[model samples]
Target: MKVVSSRDFNQDVSHAKRAARIEPIFITDRGRPTHVLMSIENFRHLTGQTETIVDLLAMPEPRDIDLDGSRPTTWDRQAKFG
Candidate 1:
């Protein structure tokens, strides 16, 4: 992981771009982390969106997912409901 202050990042954008390939580059503001820069491959891996259901599920159903119940409704005493 590489960290870069916003100033240096702006000064040397190329180095930051190259650093993003190996790992993520953390951009900080006032010593606090502001943003992260990562390679597209790493981003995909981190988000887990690239994996197919079959690949993620592996064996069988991971969990029993169902939505058989109807949507619930909430009403306030001052509000009308039909």
Candidate 2:
């Protein structure tokens, strides 16, 4: 883990970004930890959420989806139940 003050990070964003690729870079404000900088891949790996709805839809022939080919049956309004 690498720690960088907000001022330093702001002054040298390229270096901080480069360091982030290797590991998380903790950004501090007023000598206190405030944020983290990390690669997108690492963030995705940590969050365990990489796929989007568009990606799922783009998949070939998903098995779980049920497609209703017929029109929905109309409800009978005359029938009443308490």
Give the best candidate by TM-score: 2
Cα lDDT tens digits for candidate 2, 14-79: 999999999999999999999999997899899997978987798799586647846446655565
| Candidate 2: regions farther than 4 A off | 51-82
User: What overall lDDT goes with each candidate model?
Assistant: 0.84, 0.89
lDDT of 1 by residue, 36-70 (tens): 99887898888876856776678576476546755
TM-scores of all models? 0.58, 0.61
* Candidate 2 TM-score, true structure as reference: 0.61
Per-model C-alpha RMSD: 14.4, 12.5
What candidate 1 gets wrong by more than 4 Å, as runs, is 51-82
Clashing pairs in 2: none
Q: What is the lDDT of residue 22 in candidate 1?
A: 96
